[model samples]
Target: MTTASEPRTSTGVPLPPAATDQPPAPPGPAAPPQGPPAGTAAGTAPGTAPLRALLGYARPHRAVLLGTLLVVLVASASGLVQPLVAQHVLATLGSGGSVVGPIVLLGVLVVLGAGLTGLQSWWQQRTSERVVRQVRRDLVFRLIRLRVPELDSRPPGDLIARVTSDSTLLQSAATEGLVLVANGALSVVGAVVLMGVVNLELLAVTLGVMVVVGVVIMLVLPRIREAVARGQQSVGAVGAALDRTLGAARTVKANGAELRETGTAGDAIESSYQAGLLAARYVAMVKILSGVSIQAAFLSVLGVGGALVASGHLTAPALIAFLLYVFYLASPIGSLIAGAGMLQQGLGAVGRIEQVKQMAVEEDVDDASPVAVRTHSTAPAVEFDDVQFSYAGRAQALRGVTYTVGGGTQTALVGLSGAGKTTMFALLQRFYEPTAGQIRIGGVDIATLPRSEVRRRIAYVEQESPVMAGTIEDNLRYSSIGATDEDIAEALRVTRLDALIERLPDGLRTQVGTRGVQLSGGERQRLAIARALLRKPEVLLLDEATAQLDARNEQALRDAVDQAGRRCTVILIAHRLSTVTAADQIVVLEHGRVRALGTHQELVDNDELYRELAASQMLVGEDGDPVEDLAPVS
Candidate 1:
C-alpha cells in the first residue's frame, strides 16, 4: 500500500551496548524448548539461557569452534608478549645492547600480531555466520509450525525485527563479544600474575583499584540491561506503527489522513529515541566510571613505584617492567567492560526472541489416524454436534449450533454478521480445538481424523480470495504442489478464466502483483476457485465468493459454482437468494441455529423468511405469485 507520496516516519535506533561488569537476569516465561520462551519478562539475567545453548548449535561444528578458539587464544597469548618485550628492550638499551636488534624484534612482533588478528577475525566471523544460519533456520521452522490464530494478532514488522535486527545482535555478541570476554579474562589474569612476579606491592595496588571498579560496575549494569531492553522494544513498536501506516498508505491518501498516520508513527519513533537516550546515558556512566578507576589505579601504581625507586627498595629496571605489565592490564580490563555490555544486550535480545519461541506450537497429527472424508454415497453432509468454543473465556462464539448439508446439494448459510458462519470455518480448519464438539465432515468426527488429511479432503475459498505475488501459473500450482502443467490449464479452463488468460500477453505467467492487486474482484475469486479445483477436493466451502462482484462478475462466478457442484459437495454463505435458488437444499440460519431447511421452491412455499427474501427480489408477479422470469433451478 505504501508509495513515495506517503508520509514516512523514522524508526531506526543505533544498536549500542553498555560497558558494565554484570547483566540483569532474564525475565518472562521460558521460551518453548527450541528458542527463547514466550511470556518471559522483557529483560533477562546474564547467563540465564546459557552459553551452552550456543554450544548446542556449535556441537555440529565443534572442530571448527575448538580450532578457532585455539587460534584466538594463541593469538591473544602471543599478543601479550608485546609489552614484556618492549620492557626488555628498554632494559637492554639501558645496559647498551644494540638498538637495531630490539627494534627489529619489535617489528617482527607487530607483524605477527597483525597476521594473527586477521586470522582470528576471519575465523570468528565464519563460525558466527554458520551458527546464525542455524538459529534462523530453527526460528523459521518453529514460526511456520505456530497456529495461524497466533500470527493473526502479531505485528508483521515486529516479527521482521526479531528475525533481522534481534538475530544479528545475537550473532555479533556470539562471535565478537564471546572472543573478547574469553581473551580479556585471560589477559587480566596473566597480567595480574606477571605483576605479582615483578612486585607484590604494585600488584596489590592494582587489585584494590580493580575491586573498586567491580563494585561500581555491579551497581550500574542492571540499569543498563533494563534500558537496552526497553530501547529495543521501542524500536519494535515504532517499526510496527510504520508498517501499519505504510500498509494502509492508499487508504490514508484517499481519506487525507497522511498527517495523522505520520503523527502516530512519529510518536513511536519518539519513544524509541527516548529509550535510546536512556540506554546511552547509562552506557556513558559506566564508561566514565571505568575510565576514572583505570586512571586512578595507574596514578597509584606510579606514585608507589616512584617512592620505592627513590628509597632504593626497587630497581629502576624492575619498576619500569612492573609498570609495563600494569599497563598491559588496561586493554583486557577495557575489553571486559565492553564484553559485559554486549552480554547484557544479548540477554535482552534473547528474552525478546524467546517471547515468540515459547508459545506452544500446534502438534502434528499422527500419520496413521483415520481421514475425515466429507462425501458419501448416500449424502453430501457437513454437520456439527454439541459444538462449543471460546477464545479466552465463557463468551462463546458458537454454542451447540448443529446443521447438515444434504447429499449432492448446496447449502446456503444465512445469519447476522456475528451469527457464527465464520466460526464454523474456524472449527473446520481446526485452527483452535473446540471446547467440546463433534464436527462430522461426512459421518466421521473431524477430531478423530489426521489434521492434514482432513484439510486435504476439503477446499476452502476465503472471502477475499487472496492471491500471492507470483504469476497466475504459480498461484494455480499452490493448491497441489505436484500438479502438472496440464492440470493447471484444466483448472483455469474449468473456472472460465482460460479465454481471459489468453487475452493477456503472458497469460498464466503474468504477475498478480502483491495480493493480486492487478486483478479485479471477479478475477481473484476465479483464481481462488482455480486453486481449489486443482486439489479436486471432495468438499468445497465458499465464503461469500460472490458478495462483492458486479452482475457480469456474479454470473461468471455462478457458472463456476455450477461446475463445482457437478462433482463435489458445496457449502456456501451468500446473502443473495438467486445464488441459492437452484441449490438442492437451503438451510436458513439465525442466531447460530438452523431455522429452515428445504429446496428453494419448497422453502419459498413453506418458510415465511424464504418467501420474504424471494418476494423482495422483484421476481414475484402482480398476483402475489412467483414470477415466470425466475431463473430455472439447475
Candidate 2:
C-alpha cells in the first residue's frame, strides 16, 4: 500500500522512489489555484508574456493577417473621406454654390466604406478560424505525447475545455483585437489632425478632456482582464464537473445519486454564473467610461469652437466640420477599449495553453522502427532476475522475483490478490521499471530497446477486457492493422467466438455499445483473447482472461491457449489452481515473493498455501481427494 507522504504519478497512482540511475519524473499539470482572482490587476497578473506567446501562433498566417489589416485601413480611410465630403457640401451651401458635386462624392465614399468593412470582416473571420485550428492541433499533439504520469494528474474535461472554449477566445483576440487596435489608432490620429485644421483652440480643448478620461479608463481596464481570467477558470470547472458525472453515468444511476450529481454540477454552474457577473460588471464600467469621455469631448469642442466662430477667428463651415470630427472620435475610442478587453481575455487563455505546452512529453519513436525479432535458440523467452519494486514508500510489490519461461511454452503465475502478478506484466510492458532488477526477452535486456519495439513483440489482454465503442471488427482489428479477413476468422474460430459472431445481426460489422455493453462478460473476454491472437505476437500475456467465462467457454479457451502456446511464449495469471493443473510449470507467489516453483501436483504436495487455496475452491479435499464435480473451477 502507498503511504500518505509518498509522491504520486500524474494519475494519482503512487510511485516507488526513483533509483539512482533513473531520470527524474516529468512535470505535472499546472494547478488551478495559481490563476488570478477577479479583482487582480491585469498588467501585473498574466501581463504581455502570454500575449507574446499567442502571437507566435499567428506568425505562420502573417500574410493573411496583413491583408485583413490593409482592408480595415482602406475602410477607415473611406469613412474619413465622408466627413470631409460633408464639410465640402456645407461650405458650398454657405458660399451659395452648387452642392451636387459634394453630395455625389459623399455617396461614393459611403458605398466604398461599407463594401470594405464587409470584406475586412470576412477575411478576419477566416484568419481567426485558421489560428484556432492551429492552436487546437498543437494542444492535441502535446496531450497525446504527454507522459503517462502527467496525464493521470489532470482532469480530462479541463483539458477538453482548453482546446474548445479557451481556443475560441484566442480566435477573437488574434484577428479582431489586432484590427481594432490598428484601425482605431489610425482613426483617432486622423480625426485629431482634421480637428486641428478646423481650429487649434477647439482641438486643444478636446484633447485636454480626452487625456484625463483616458487615464481613468486605462486604470480600470486591468480589472476586466482579471475578471475574465477568473471567469474562464470557472468555465473549466464546469466542464470538469460535467465530465465526472457523465463518464460514470451508470454508477450515478445505479446508486440513485441523481440529486447528488445534479447538486455537484449545480455548484459548478453557480460559480461560472458568479464569475460571468463579475466580468460583465467590469465590461459595463468600461462602456460607461468610454461613453462619458466621448460626450465630454463633444461638449468641450462645441463650447470652445462656438466662441472662436463668434470672434470671427473660425468660419461656420469649419466649426461644423470640427464638431463632426468630435462625434467621429467615438468609433475609434470604443474600438480601442473593446480591443484591450479582448486582448486581456486572450492573454488569460494563452496562459493556460502555454502551461500545457510546457509539460514534459515522452520520447516519440519513429513508427517505422524495426520490430524486435526472436532469434535466440536456447534462451528463455521471458526472464525476471531479482526484480524488486515498491509503490512510493510502501512495501515492495515484487521482491527478488526471479523466474524464467522457456520459449514456445506456457507458464502459469499463481498468486492471491496484491501478490504482484499484474505488476510483473506491467514491468514486462515497461509501464513501470523495477527499482532494481533486470527483465529480458529472448535473452536481450528489454530496457535497452525502445518502448514501441518492446510492445510490438508482445500482446497483452488486460483482466477487464476493455473494448472501444465501435463495430465488432473495429475492436478485433484494433491491434493488428494488417490483419486480413481470413486471419480474423481463424482467430474467432480458435477462441470459440464464431458462434457469437454468427448470431449477431451484422456479423463483424455489428456495433458494440460503449464499453462493450452489448456483449456478455464471457463473450467480451473471448473477444479480447481473439483480438490478441490476431496480432500474431511473439509473446502473449493474458491476465486472467478466463476469469469471467463459463465452464464450456473456459475449457474452449484453455484449448485455444494450448494451441497458441505451441507457436509463441505464453504467460498467464490465474487464481484458480485447477486452471494451471496441466501447465508446463506453476510459480506460486505470496506477499511479493516466489514461494514455490514446480508442477501443479508438486506444488499441491509441497506448498501449504497452494493446498489451502486449492481446498477453498474445492479443487482438492482436506483428505487429499480430488473434487469430482468442479470442472476446472470455472
Candidate 3:
C-alpha cells in the first residue's frame, strides 16, 4: 500500500494524446541500419534453412496446400490450351482451314479454368486462416511464458504489434501471395516447354534472357528484404515511443510537452516511411529491368524466326505458334520478379517474429522434487544470509545483507530509496537471483523450491500494488482463482475495501479502469491487501504498503495488517519511523549493507545513523526514548 508520500510520475496519465490521436511526424532522411536482407546471408553462401523453416508452417495444412497446387496446375494447363486454340483458329482462318475443333477446345478450357479458380480460392483462404491462427496462438503462448525480467525491457505496444500486424503479413503471404507465386511459376515452366515444341532455337534464346533476368532478380532481391526489415524495425520503434508517450500522456499535457512528444513520434514514422520508400524503389527498378529484358527477348525471337522463315526452314503457322509461346513467357517473367520481391518481404517478417522466439524462456522446474506449499497457522519465518544483487548494471542494489524474522514476529526494513529494501523482497520472490548468498522461507532455500511454490507461500503487496487492466473482481481473483464471491467479500472486508466496493455502481464487478485509475491510491492499496488476504499466504511482504495513504487510510491499513498478522508473518519495508516502531525487529540498511538490526527504540539509542534519522524526524521523547506518537512495537 502506498502513502500520500509515495512518488508518482510528475505527469499522471496512462497514455499521451499523440498516441490516440495523431501518430508522430515522419522522420528526417536517415539511412536505415545496415544488415543482410531477410532470407539472405551476408558474406555467406545461400542456404536452404530459411525455406525449410517456412515450409514447416505449411506442413500441418499439407493436404490443402497440395490441393492448391493441383488446382493451380490444372488452371495453368487450361490457360495454356487457350493460347494454342487461339493460334490454331488464327492459322485456320488465315489459310482457309477448319476452326470448329479449336473453338470447341477453347470452350472446354474456359469451363475447366473456372472450376480450378474456384477451388484455388477456397483452399487459399482456408489454409491461410489456419496458418495465421497457429502463428498467433504460438506467439501468444510464447509471450505469456516469457520470464518477467526479459519482458520488463520491452514495450507493450511493440509486442502487441507482433501479435497483430506481423501475423497479418504472414497470413497474406501464405494465402493469396503463395497462390500467385505457385501459379506464376507453373505458367512459366509450361510456356517454356511449349516454346521448345514449337521451335527449339527460339526457345534457347528465351532461356538465355530468362537466365540473365534471374541473375538480376537475385541481385535486387536482397535489397528489398533489407529495406523491408528496416521498415518493420522502424515501425516497432515508433510503437515503443508512442507507448511511452501515451503511458505518460497526462504528464506531457500537464507539462505542456505535447509538441515535443509528437515530434519524437513523427520522427519514428518518418523513419519507417523512408525505409518503405527504399524497398519500393528497388522493386520498381527490378520491374523496369525485367520488362525491358522480356521485350528484348521477344523481339530477338521474332528476328531469329523471321530469318529462318525467309530461308524456307520454318512454316508460317509454326512461326506464329512460336510467337504465341514467346508472348506467354511475359507472365512468368513478371511473376518471377514479383515472387522475389514478396519472398523478401516475408523473410523480413519472419526475422522479426524469430527475435521474440529466440529469447530465453523461464526455466522449467523438475518434477522429481515437487514442492507442495501449505501455509501453517503460525506466522511464517524468513532468513537471509549474505545476499548480494545487482540490477543488470555494475552497481549493487544489495550486498551481504543478512537478516531473520521468526514466526509471529513483525519485521520492518527501513532505508532511503535504493537502500536495498526492495531488492531484498525481489530476492525473496526470485525476480532476480542474488549474485552471492542465500534466502530461505521456513528453512527451505527459496531457490531450491520451484518458483510457483515459493511465490504461493509469500503474499506481496508492493508499493505501487499494480491493479491490472480489468474489473475489480478480476484483479482480486488473481491471488486465488478458486475464490468464491463470498470469499472475495470476506477478504475485502478484512482489508476495509468492502465499503469502497459497496459505493461503486457494480460493486465487486466494477471496472477498476486501466491500472486502477478509477480507484484512489489508498483504494488500490486496499484492493492489493484484499487480494493477498484471499491467498492467505504464510508470509506477508509489504513494500511501502502504507507510504501513500493519508492518516485515516494509514490507520485503516495498519489495522488490516494487525488483523491479518494474527494468522501469518508480516515483513514490511517502510521509510516512516512511526510505521517501523510497531515492528518486533527493524533492519536498517545503508549502502546495500545491513548497518543495524533491532527494535526502533533500541536502534535509536545505539546506532548512529538510526539515531540521526530518528532525531531528524523528531521521533524522540524528552527522556531520549522514542516518543509515544512513534508507536513502539506492539
User: For residues 30-105, what per-residue lDDT tens digits would candidate 1 score against the true structure?
Assistant: 1111122321332333355534443354566667656766776676666567666777787888887877876787
Better of 1 and 2 by TM-score: 2
Q: Which ten contiguous residues of candidate 2 have the minimum total lDDT?
A: 20-29
Tens-place lDDT per residue, model 2, 466-568, is 9889998999988877788999999999888898789888999998898898888888888899989887778889988889987778888999889888878
Shift of residue 153 alpha carbon in model 1, Å: 2.5
Which pairs clash in model 2? 10-149, 10-152, 10-153, 11-152, 11-153, 15-392, 16-392
How do all the candidates rank in terms of TM-score, highest first? 3, 2, 1
lDDT of 3 by residue, 1-634 (tens): 2223121221121111111111112222232222234334333233354444456667788788878988878887887777778878988899898889899989999999899889888888888899889988988877776654445445655666667766776676655566677878878888888878778998898788778877887898888877877777777667777777776677779999888878877887998899999999999999888888778788988899899899998877788877777776676667666766776676666666655665435454323322224656576689998887655433666778788888867888877665777767867877656777878888888877766778778889988788998999898888777788898888887777888877888987899887888888888988888888888778889988876677777787788888777878899988777776778899988888999999877887788888877766778754457565664321
Model 1, residue 464: displacement in angstroms? Answer: 1.0
Report the poorest 10 consecutive residues by lDDT, candidate 1.
15-24
lDDT for predicted candidate 2 compared with the true structure: 0.77
What are the Cα lDDT values of the candidates?
0.68, 0.77, 0.73
**Residue 350 of model 3: what lDDT?**
64
Cα deviation at 634, candidate 2, in Å, is 5.9
Cα lDDT for residue 95, model 1? 89
Which runs of model 3 end up more than 4 angstroms from their true locations?
A: 1-52, 91-97, 174-182, 363-377, 621-624, 628-634
Write the candidate numbers in order of decreasing lDDT.
2, 3, 1
